[model samples]
Target: MAYKSLLTLASSAEGVAAAVDAAARVALASDAHLDALALGVDRSQIGYSYVGSGAVILQIAMERAEEEARLNGKALKDALAAQGPDLRFSLDSAVAQLGALTDLVSSRARYADLVVLPKPYGKGSGPEAEAVIEAAMFEGQAPVLVVPERGFAAGAAPRRVVLAWNQSREALVAARRALPFLKAAEQVVITIVDPPAHGPERSDPGGMLCQLLVRHGVKAEVAVLARTLPRISDVLARQCQDLDADLLVMGAYGHSRFREAILGGATRNMLESAQVPLFLAH
Candidate 1:
């Protein structure tokens, strides 16, 4: 299956360019329609008690934020127009109520084939961005394409890709959802790190997953590495670099979110450490 419809959310002017570039690239690659929603914070939903003069300042700040959001939306439209001459794309703005931003984004993403989002930057690592990611991966029930904060290319989809396989339900789902990308990629390496000794479905390491992908017209090779590092994410990152992979496809949040939050897991570590594009699903 191919990605026919894609969705993305832009939260700030600073990240609008990158977000549009990444989204447009994917849309162009898949010959899909892109729908980008620019986000603005609604001050009325804020819980701060406004004092006499403080209320005026807060109102002004919120107005500025709203205006910035509008400008960012326009920039997105212009960028999409320029980058996607043969691609279908649209841009609009959405005011995110304080507590309902995640819900709004999640509900909107449910209608999309894939969701593209910008990775967190220095000061951009706020609740809003985190919520958008959480909403897309868990609540949206769609594959999430995360672009890095810096140096995002708007021209082409990744040619070389690495698939981190673990024989888990989430990993299988992620691989299947990423079939389009895998089939299009020039090279696909199914990297399995420290596979379990035995699982319910027993077979040669990575062979079963590889055969499933082959049936989909994706020719992939399996690379099994012994678990020698402290964090599997680090190994995956190194493998991506060694293979010169432009994209990494893997499962997200295989374990409970709360558990990953407290103890850390491959999904969390990769989300934070990966510099290349990531195609992730729950």
Candidate 2:
């Protein structure tokens, strides 16, 4: 199904316009409406451990956080207004005050068709931000399009799309969810990595995926990449770059949380070091 509403979460006013522009582009292409959610983070609540951790301290912290949220909200609203009158914008703030990062995202995932989240800034491990992304993938039920923090302009329609296929349930779901963008793309590539030793019959799901896309009226090509490299994320990133792909479509492959940490192999690697816009669905 085509996306009807796009919900993008913004933390700062810096990339707010770009985020809205990207959302508006998608809305225009899919005939959808763009809804923007600007998140205000209370830095004081950064290490807040419990609800009853000194009421006076908590109240002061929450107040500062709310003020920061308001400033961010006003900046975003003003930016959108400057862009033009055609774009529809909605402003709201949430107290990410309680629970883990995942809990916050899960709570917000209920309201939108899709979520657009910005990559965390700086070079340190973005475990918290990554948690937010993971929560959206597992709990949101809808697709999450992650925007890179630097380089590349936002709101540009993807001209080339790549599907990272492993023939898993999550991968198949991601493929199906990417149909709208895939159909509109000028070129589509289905990349399979480290296939089983047997063959296409019992080995290659990517071949089957390519066939499926053809049936769906997508002009797609299948290619296999050797996984000799240490990380699959590196391999996939290189493949996308070599193919000159603007967007990458991949299944959000991961086992249940208790079984493993930070999703699974591919999901973890890609989320941590994603180079292009990725459309992930579980």
Cα RMSD for predicted model 1: 2.8
lDDT of each: 0.79, 0.70
For candidate 2, lDDT tens digit of each residue in 99-171?
4546667767756677776654335323445566667777767788876654233444687888987767888
Write out the backbone clash pairs for model 2.
Answer: none
Each prediction's RMSD over C-alphas, in Å, is: 2.8, 3.4
* Model 2: lowest-lDDT 10 consecutive positions: 120-129
Error of 2 at 145 (Å): 0.4
Q: After superposition, how far is residue 47 of candidate 1 from its true place, in Å?
A: 4.8
Residue lDDT tens for model 1, 49-114: 555666776677678668857876876777677774687877778776557777888888998998
**Model 1 lDDT at residue 16:** 59
